[model samples]
Each structure stands twice: as C-alpha cells, then as structure tokens.
Target: MTTANLHAPLGAVSVLRLVDGIMNFKTNLVEWNESRQTRKALSQLSAAQLEDIGVTRADIDKL
Candidate 1:
C-alpha cells in the first residue's frame, strides 16, 4: 500500500475518536449537572419537609 492509503485510514480513525470523546464528555457533563440540581433542591428542604418525604439531610449527600 502507498503512504497516502495508510494515512487516510489513520485520519479517519482519529476523527472518529475525537467525536466519541466529545460525545462522552457531553453526556457526563449533563449527568453531573442534573445530580447537582437534585442535591441543591434536596438540601433546601426543612427537617419536617424532608421527613414528609422520608429523607434526611444526612441522607441527601448519599443520593
């Protein structure tokens, strides 16, 4: 095979890897943001309010 043929496949594989990395990063970021929002919402609840939902401030960190 010629040098051009080998380089073409390598270039395509690198592009695919770059795209996959970007997609994985985006998915992780979205999940992290959602978890952060949930934690924030739970932390703002009063003790009674938390108990009504059967959750405690200490347990909130585990979620």
Candidate 2:
C-alpha cells in the first residue's frame, strides 16, 4: 500500500530477530550443558549417598 511496504520482501530477516535468536541459543546451550553435568554427577553417587540427599537414581534426570 505504502512505498516502504511495497518495497519490502517476503523473506526479510530483522535485526531484533537475529539478535534474539543468538541470545536464546547461548542461553539454551549453557543451561543444557550445566544440567547434563549435574545429572552426570548425581548419577554417579551411590544409592545411600543419593538417599542422604533425598534423591533416588530414578529422580536424577527428573530434576
């Protein structure tokens, strides 16, 4: 309808969207990596040690 609107393409990528995607990627990577390490450590504990902390082997990934 307008000059700017008429010039716009269907496949345009905005700066805000690009920045948001990068930020989200970094956040997810950090969170997943931290959770993986924590789950690994919890899974390594003996059953008794796990009970002392009030978590069972089945609960490791659930947390």
Candidate 3:
C-alpha cells in the first residue's frame, strides 16, 4: 500500500515534466516567429528610414 502511494506521486511528477517541456517548446517557437517578423520589417526599411528609427543599416543584418 505504501509503495502504491509513492508511485502515484511519481506518475504525477512525470506528467508535469512533460507538460513543462511542451510549454517551453511553444514559447521558443513564438520567440523565433517574432524575431523573423522583426528582421523582415527591418529589411524593408531604407537606410534613411532605419536611421530615423535610430537603427543603422549595419544593425539591420545583426538583428
């Protein structure tokens, strides 16, 4: 009976770890998508436009 009780908590912990992993994956995907969109928008800006926003042409590729 004691061993059965221990197993139940361990099983719950395993499920929690799986849920955490899924959430981390989702967070990373969203960050990557936002970064890509930012780069795309930056690329569309001319040197003057970029400078107007305080971003240099050299900075665009770096971002």
Full-model lDDT, candidate 1: 0.89
- Which residue pairs show collisions in model 1? none
Clashes of 3: 0
| Candidate 3 stretches greater than 4 Å from native | 1-8
Q: What's the ranking of the predictions by lDDT, best on top? A: 1, 2, 3
Model 3 agreement with the true structure over 1-63: per-residue lDDT tens digits: 344544556578889999999999999999988988998999898988988999986786676
TM-score of each: 0.74, 0.75, 0.77
RMSD to the hidden true structure, all candidates: 4.5, 4.4, 3.8
Q: Which ranges in model 2 have alpha carbons more than 4 Å from their true place?
A: 1-13
* Best-matching candidate per lDDT: 1
Which candidate order results from sorting by TM-score in descending order? 3, 2, 1
- Cα deviation at 19, candidate 3, in Å, is 0.6
Model 1, 1-63: lDDT tens per residue? 645544556578889999999999999999999988999999998999999999999888886
Kindly give the stretch of ten consecutive residues in candidate 3 with the minimal lDDT sum.
1-10
